[model samples]
Target: MTTSRTYEDLVKEAVDASVDGWDFSWFEGRATEERPPWGYARSMAERLAVASAALDVQTGGGEVLASAPSLPPLTAATEGWPPNVAKATALLHPRGAVVVASPEDASLPFAEGAFDLVTSRHPVRTYWPEIARVLRPGGTYFSQQVGPASAVEVVEYFLGPQPPEVRDARDPERARARAEEAGLEVTGLQEARLRMEFHDIGAVVHFLRKVIWMVPDFTVDRYEPQLRSLHARIESEGPFVAYSTRFLIEARKPGR
Candidate 1:
């Protein structure tokens, strides 16, 4: 289907596409990425069904938490973006989860040792001290994080080869050390390298626009030459291939 489309047509279609929610349904036929083996949402739901209190951090549009079959009696979620906050509130309130507007890197607004469980999916940054402070003595923090060198192909394609620091930013070992330093014991950690394929330039444009941090300041007008070149490559060679790294980490507070 993409082979029959023009670059301008595809780019315009992607640019006009609305990235209203957290789900990747928009990339249905244009692109595809392998899912991590761990079914994070289902796993989180199993835990939430038994917990007395729980909190979800950086809940974009409340998509994942809202999918839970059962929620804790006391459930809350935090989101930094105003638009996402409103969206999350709307989606979560019916499920009995209150949404709070809080920055991802800032201290959580809840009282210390408030929640029995905390969760986040692909949080841009995790503040270990703050996470530890908000959890009860025996509470757990479970998250699926974007691991180091994730989608490096896309990043390098646009901004050349990056330094080792940039490539190693979200190291799982560093996360484990930080959690341990904050008085939490690391329980489980698993990682996966997922294959990603972009069938056309439109999907690439939409992806970069949705995941803004991938390019920081991505603009079609500014990156037209690169986009055009990439479009030509895809047209002649086939779907552009890339890999995304992800990790699942679980940490628990001691002193039960």
Candidate 2:
């Protein structure tokens, strides 16, 4: 006799099937790679070590924790993440890292004055306020984010055949204002633009879907019509360049 499966089991199977079909990299070989390094991981770890007491906000994939396991003990939390991610993170940080499944815009699980250094990369915009709220006075907050420039290929592939209005590091004033509003004094900012190469447009599309974390609102399904037009355009225009903009900004909370 066959046993009946629960609704949860069916949903889990569906989700797992989708994930398995996608050729996504879990970065299992992170420990072996030599060149380029994980810049965001190493850099954020360094800044946190400087602050003494630190928190890694939304520690997805645990790469940052893996990068700096020897640094000062760190508290790790990932807003609205699954237990699997938390479990993986624990492998790198056994003692202090704890996962929180709450949305990043809402109140965090940790108490006030919980940390002196807060490091985040590629977190949703709503999480910034919560990040500001959790750091100790006179603390440092460092975030390396994939800026609007990251959507270049997607915009070109889809989005009505025209480029989206994306401003680069030239918009320093706006960047400073944003950090200040988060209750942090802006210190330094840098934008590193890199051209990601793809063998063909199909490869570009695959990378966008799997590795890039394209905004949920602008998924491949939503942009399929435009993507077809984009594919045609690329066939006519030849190889294309995907521009990725990496922004590194450091800020400090005011001391009493």
Candidate 3:
């Protein structure tokens, strides 16, 4: 990587860039992250091929669901963000899937036991009970979630060291417990820690901007000092490295 580019140029480009939808195409050359081995999209598509009715929760731009080569006869997806709702609708409607405008925290808009398959990818938050409620007996719920301490390297660099509870808020075990409590049987669960790299400060900026929850109040003005220092470090050190944790979980509703 070259260090000749000024920090001002990189950060401004990222800051002004659009972060709409779930697409991360803008970071093609600026950053990179190792993908999990489970091949979440392929796996979800395989299950979708066999399902009779399916619903995708927190379907950000319907990207993952839209990637499926086949969908059940009755397919639908829910997204809370208006921009994402529009994006998802535009993508999924042509494929015979209805996109619903629903908040992540609100109850699912469908009737009970309406879907035989439920899927989500990197949801802001998983509503276990709601998922179970919408799933039919013997239905399956599959999701790829951000695991505990995901991308904490960047969090710590931007802010500071976080408490144990805050860092472990998204633990897989907690998710397992919640699913069990919701009357679902855990079928499979796996976790992975993958390498992440930022070639420049702009990638970091664009990342934080896209994934707002990572740093709730991330603004270049507020973190300019830290950004400048990190940018310098990257210029000298080649690229900044971080590890992001992810988990794949599958659970089933028990019944005949």
Task: After the best TM-score superposition of candidate 2, give how far the Cα of residue 93 lies from its true spot, in angstroms.
Answer: 4.3
The candidates, ranked best first by TM-score, are: 3, 1, 2
TM-score of each: 0.98, 0.69, 0.98
Weakest 10 consecutive residues of candidate 1 by summed lDDT: 1-10
Candidate 2, after superposition: displacement of residue 18 in Å?
A: 7.9
Instruction: Output the TM-score of candidate 2.
Output: 0.69
Off by over 4 Å in 1: none
Off by over 4 Å in 3: none
lDDT of 3: 0.94
Tens-place lDDT per residue, model 2, 44-119, is 7666566667776665655655567455555665645564365545554465566555665667777777788877
Ranking by lDDT: 3, 1, 2
Where does candidate 2 clash, by residue pair?
none
Model 1 agreement with the true structure over 115-178: per-residue lDDT tens digits = 9999999998999999999999999999999999999999999999999999999999999999
How does each model score on lDDT?
A: 0.94, 0.57, 0.94
> Which residue segments of model 2 deviate by more than 4 Å?
1-38, 83-87, 93-95, 161-172, 211-239
Native-referenced Cα lDDT, model 1: 0.94
